[model samples]
Target chain A: MPLTINNYADGILHGVSFEVQRGENLIILGANGVGKTTLAKVLCGLLPSDAVNIGGMIPSQTYSEERAKRINYIPAKMEVFDSYLSVAEFLSLSHFNQTISIDEALSKLNILHLKTHSCQTLSSGESQLVLTASALLHSAVYTLFDEPTANLDPTRMKMLFELLKNDTTLPSKIIITHNLDLAYRLGFDVLYLKEGRVAFHGSSEAFFDQTHLDALYGSSVQKVNNHVVVAL
Target chain B: MKKLLLLTSLLLLAAAPFFGQIDLPLDKLLQSGTMEHQVFFELRLPRVLLAFLVGGILSLGGLVFQVVFRNPMSTPFTLGVASGATLFTAIAIIAGFSTFSPLFAFLGAMLTVIVLFAIAARFQNYDPTALLLVGIALSFFYSAALMVAFYLSTLQESYEIMRFTMGSLDVVGFNNIWLLGMVSGLLLGLVYHYRKAFQALLTSYEFAFLQGIHVKKLSYTLLFGVSVAVGVAVSMTGPIGFVGLIIPHILKTLYRVSADKLLWQSFFYGGIFLVLSDLIARNLGESDLPIGVVTSFVGAPFFIYLLLQRKS
Candidate 1:
C-alpha cells in the first residue's frame, strides 16, 4: 500500500502531490516556512484534508485502530498538556502493538530511567527521546517523524540515525529534517520542497550531487567525503 | 492520611442530617410520628442528598470543562450555562410563571448548549480557547439581560430572583432528590465510560489524535453530556458556584494525580465538600445561609492556599 497526495492545496501548499510505496522510506527536506509541517499534518490527518490517502483509505476520514495501524506522525516538539502524565503512562496509551512492551521501547531509546518522570519536567532532548519511545510503542506501518534529530546531542543523533538507517523499528519511515549529512547517510528517496512545491523528487545520490546541492542550497553547503556539510 | 480523611468525611456525611436548629436524636428519628422524624425525612435528608448530588455534578462537570477547554479555570458555568439558567429563571419569576421556573431554567441551559455547539461547528479549527471566549461573551450578554429582568419585575419578584441568584438547597422531599440522583448517576457513568478518552485528552489534542482517538467528537460528546447534566442540577439548586471550580482542584492536590484519575475522586470529595458547606450553613446561624454564599466563602480561601502552597 502506497501513501498518495493529489492536487492538495492548503493555504501554504498549492497542488503539491507525491507518493511513498510500502516498505519504501522517504526524506522530506525544505527551507524554513516551506509548509513541510503542514504537509506532514495533512498526511497524518491532523489537518484534515481529502487530498491525501493511505493504503486505499482517506486518513482524515478514517479513525481509531484502522487509522492508527496505517500511519503515525511524531511531531517536532513534545506537546503534553497534563503536568502529571508520566512517560510510562503516555507510552502505555499508544501501545497499540502489544508485542512491544513499554519498558522495552524505553530501554531501546536509553530512556528507561525517565519512564516514571512527568513529561512536563523533561528537557527538550529528553522529551524527544520519550517521543521516540512512544513512536516505537505505536509501531504503525508508516511513521512520519518531523525533525527527529533537531534537539539531539551528537551521540543521540547517531543512535537515531542508526535506528532510521537499519529500519529496526517501523517498516516505512518518512523523516522530515534539515540535517543534510543525516539525510545523505540514510540513503532514502528524497522529496525536496521549495516555495510550496516539490522542487525535486529523486534518489539520494542524485539529490546530493555537488551541482544539485549548489542549486538547492546555493553557496551554503559543501559535499566532503560523500557527506553533505555546511560550506562554512 | 488518606484513610483518616475518608473516615472523617464519611462520618460527617452521616452526622449531617441529624443536626439542625431543631435537633433530632436517634430515638426521635426512629419514632415514626414525631416532628423530628418528619424533619429528618422531609427536610434534612432531601436537602443533604440534593447538596451532594449537585456538588458531584458540578465538580465533575468542571473537570470535564477544564479537560475539554484545556483551561484550568473553566467550569460548567464558564460557558454561560448557569447564567442562561439564571436569566430564564428571572424571566419566569417576572412573568408570573414562577412555578415553572425550574422547567424554564432547564430550557435555558439546554438552549445555551445548543447555541454553543452550533457556533462550534462553524469554527475553522478545533480551537477550544475560541469557544471559551464565546462562552464568556454569552455570559456577559445573559447577565445584561438578567439586569433588564430585575428592572422590570415587581419588588417581590425581584427579591425571588435575588434569592435564586444566591443559590439554595431548599428541597422538600424525595422526588427532586431522585431526579438529581439519576442525573448525577448518568454523568458519573458517562465519565467512567469515557475515562480512557479523558486520559488521552489530558495530553495535547494532537497527541490524542495521533493515538487514534477522535478528539473533536469525543470532546463534543463529553461537553454536551456534562452541560446537560449541569443544566438539570442548576435548574434545581439555582446555579451553585465554586463547587465545580474548587473541588476538582482540591482533589487533584490531595491525590497528586492527573485529572483523568480523579473523576470518581472528584465526585466523592465534591459531594463531601458541599455537604460540609451545607452543614456549616445550617449550623452557623439561626436561619440557614444561602448554600452558594457558604461554598464561595469556604472554597475561595482554600483554593488560594492550595495554589500558594503548590507554588512555594
Candidate 2:
C-alpha cells in the first residue's frame, strides 16, 4: 500500500498532507524553519501522529519489524551517545536488510577504513557518509533522509548523488535538502513547503519551470542550460 | 593492560575475606566449631559477598541510568533512590523501629520510583531531562524531610542515622546474600536480554525508535528493573556511593568498547572495587572505615585522573 499522510498537523506544521506510492521517490524542498524536518519526523512516526499511514497501518502506531520494514528516518546529524561506539558497530545496528552486508555498505560509502574508529571521533562529513551507509543497509520500504548532503565535500556529494539516483540503493527515498541544484539534478517529484504549508507538489518539470522558480524564489533562481541554479 | 587489570581484580576479590581486622587462622577456618571458622564463614564471608553483590548491582544500575538519561553524570541514585532510603532509615530510627529500617528504606525507595513514574506518565512526550529534573527536586524534598527527622531524634539516634548514611557491609549470615544474588541475577538477565535494543539507544532515542524499538516502553522497563534492584540494595546496605558513578566510566575507558558490550565487565570490576575498598577499610584502622567513605576516597582521585587523561 502507498504511504499517505492525510492532513497531518503538529507544531509548525499545519494540515500537511501527501502520498508516496510504492517504488516512488520524492524530494522535499523548503527554506529554513519551514518545518521540512518536522514533517519528515511526522511522516516516519518519530513525532507520533495518527495522520500518517503506510500500508493501511499508522506509522506512529506500529512496532517491531513491521514498522521497521515499512519506514525509516535518518536525521541530519549522526548522534552517538557512547564514546566508544565504533562506526562498524553503529552500522551493524541498522543492518536489518539481509541482502546488504555491513562491509558492503561501508565499502560503497568508501568508509571501510573507518570501521573501527569511534563514531564520536569522526568528522561531520565522515559521519554523514556513515549515516548514509546505514540507510542503504536499513533498506526500509520508505526511507526519509533529512539533509543528507549537508556535510559532504564536492567529490563525496557527487558520489552520494549518484547513489541516490540509483534505484537499487534504496526502495523509495524521501530526501529533505536545501540544495536546489541537487534536487533538480535528481529530477524527482518535488514537494515544497512554505510557512508549514505545501507550496508546490508536482513533477520536477512543472516545479522547476522558469516562471514557477521565479514566483517561488523572487527571480533569484534561474534555469540555465536546463539546470536549476540560485543567483547567490 | 585490560588483562592485567582483570587479573588484579580477581586476586583482590580472592584475598579480601582474609584481610579483616580480626585474623582468622587459615588452619582453624575450615575446622567446624572453631572461633576462626565461625568468624570466617559467619562474618567475613557474608560481609564480602554482600559487598560484591551490592557493588555489582550499583555499577550495572549506573550504566543503565547513564544510557537511559544520556548523561555521563547520572548514577543509580540520580533518581533520589538513595535519598529516599536514607530518609526512611532516619525515620525508622526516630520511630524506634530501627530493627526494621531495611523495610522502611525499601518502601521509601519504591515510593520514589512510583512517584517519578507517575509524574513521567503525565508528560505529553518522553522527555528524559524533565524526568531528571523531577528526580532532583524529589531528592531535595526528601533531604528536607530527613533534616526534620534528625532534628526530632536523640543524640544516639542521630549517630545511628549518620552511620547508615555513611554506608556499611556488616552482615553476619547468608540470608541477605541469597536475596541479593537473585536480584543481581535478574538485573543481569534483563540487561543481557535487551542488549541489542540498548545498543540502538546508544545512538539516539529517535534513531532507536526508527529501528522498531518501543523507546518509551523499553526505557521504562529498564528503568523500573534498575530501580527495584537498587532499592533492595540500598535497603540492605544503606547506599554505598561512588561505585555506581565511577565503575561504568572506568570500565568504558579501559575496555574501549560500547556500554552494551561492557555489561559483564562493569559488574565484575564493580564487585572487585568494593571488595578492595572494604579490605582497606577493614585493615587500615583500629575500627573499620565506612564503605561509602572508602569508595569516595579511592574512587574520586582515580576518576579525576581518568578524566584528565581522556582530555589529553
Candidate 3:
C-alpha cells in the first residue's frame, strides 16, 4: 500500500493531497511560510489527522513498532530537553533497523567523534548531522526530512547530497527543502507548495524547466550548465 | 562523586533516627520493652521512614512532572494537588472530622487530579501550557477556598489547619510507613517500566511521538500514577514542599545525567534530603520546626545557586 494524504485541509493548508508508493522517493519544495513544515507535521501525524495514511494505516492511529516501521519525520533542528543526553544515547532510541549500528550511522555522517557529546551542546550543523544519523538508524519505510541541509556547511551538504542521491540509506525519502539547486540535482519527483496549495507536482525536469522556473520564481532563479541557481 | 554522595546518603539514613529530640542510648534502645526502645522503634524509626518515603514520592513525582510538562519549575504541588489536600484538611479540621483529615486530604488531591485530566481531555491537542495554566488557576481557587475554611474555623481548628499546611512528620507507628512504602514502590515500578519512553520524552514531545511512544497515552499514564502517589504522600505528610521540586533538580545537577538515568537517584536523594531536613528541624531548638520550613530554607538558596552556576 502507498503512503497517501487524501485532500488533507487544515488552517494553514488548503486541500493538500499526495501519495507515495513503496520504494518511490519524493521531494517537497516550497518558498518560506508556504506551510511546507506544517504539511510535513500533518503527514507524519504529529498534528494528528485522519487524512494521512501509510500502507492502509493512519499514522496517528498506529502505535509502537507497527507505526515506527512505517514512517518517520526528522525536523530541521534537533531539540533535546535534557542537558546531559549524549548523541549516542539519542541515536539508540531510533535504532530499530538492526542492519546499521549507531556507530556506522555516525561514521557515515563523519560524526563518530561526536558520539559522546551531549546533544544539547552540539552546534546547529553538528546537531543536524546527528539528526540525520538518527534517521539512518531508524531506516523507516517513509522518512520525511525537513530542511536536512539547512545548517550544513558545503562539505557536509555534499556528503548529505551523496547519501540522498544514492537512495541506499532509507527506502523512500520525502525531503522538504528550499534549496532548488539541491532539489534539481536530486532529480526526484517534486511537489511544490505555493500559499498552502499544490502549485506544481511533476517530474523534477518539468518543474525545473526554464519557463516553469521563470513563471514561479521570475528572474530571481536561473539554470546554468544544467544546474539550478539563484540570480544573485 | 556519585559514590561519595551515595555513601553520605546511606550514612544520613542510618543516623537520622538517633539524632532527634529524645536521644535513645544504644544499649537502652536495644532492650525490648524500655521507654527508650519504644521511643526508638515506635516514634523515631517510623518518623524517619515516613519522611524518607514521602520525600522519595515527592521527588519522583517532581521529576515526572518536569519531564511531562517540559518545564523545570513544575512539580506535583504546582498542579494544585497539594493545595487541594491542604484545603480539604482545613475543611476537615473545621468540621470536627480532624481524625479523618488524612482521608479527606487524599480525596481532595484525587479530585483535583480527576478535574485536571477532565480539562486536559477537552484540549484539541496535547497542550501542556494550557494544562499548566489550568493547574495554576485551580491552585488559586483552592487557596481562596482554604481562606474560607480558615474564616469559618475556631481558633484551635485554624491552628490545626495551619500546622497541616506547613507540613509535619510526626507519625507514631509503622502503619502509615507500610502504606507509604508500598505506594513509593508502585510509583517507582511504573516509572522504571516506562524508563525508555521517559528518555524519549527528555528529547521533546514530538520526538517521543515519532518514536512510536504513544506520547499522549504515556504522558497521561505517568501523570496519573504520579498524582495518585503524590495524593497519598500529601495526605500523610500534609504537603511537604521543596522536596519534590528541589530533589530532582539537585540530583540532575549532581549526576549530570539525563533525568531518566536519575530516577532511582532522585527518589533516594529526595528521601535523604527530607530526612536530613527533618534532622535539622528536630535538633534546631526546644520545639521542632516545621518540616516544610526547613525544606524551603535549604532548598530555595541551593536551587538559586544551581541556577546561577548554570548561567555562568
User: Where does candidate 2 stray beyond 4 Å?
Assistant: none
TM-score of each: 0.98, 0.98, 0.98
Q: Per the 3 Å backbone cut-off, how many clashing residue pairs does candidate 1 have?
A: 0
iRMSD values, candidates in order = 1.0, 0.7, 0.8
In model 3, the runs with Cα more than 4 Å from the true position are: none
Error of 2 at B226 (Å): 0.9
In candidate 2, chain A reaches a TM of: 0.97
Q: Which stretches of model 1 miss by more than 4 angstroms?
A: none
Q: Give the range of the ten consecutive residues with the poorest summed lDDT in model 2 chain A.
A: A162-171
- TM-score for the first chain in candidate 3 comes to 0.98
How does model 2 do on interface RMSD, in angstroms?
Answer: 0.7
* Ten-residue stretch with the least lDDT total in model 1 chain B: B249-258
DockQ scores of the candidates = 0.76, 0.89, 0.83
After aligning candidate 2 to the native by TM-score, how far in Å is the CA of A13 from where it should be?
A: 2.0
Q: Compared with the true structure, what per-residue lDDT tens digits does model 1 show for residues A1-232?
A: 8899998997888889999888889999999999999999999999888889987898888878888888999998998777787888888889988888999988888889998898889999999989988888898888999999999999999998987787566888999999999999999999999889898999999999899888877878998887888977
| Model 3 pairs in collision | none
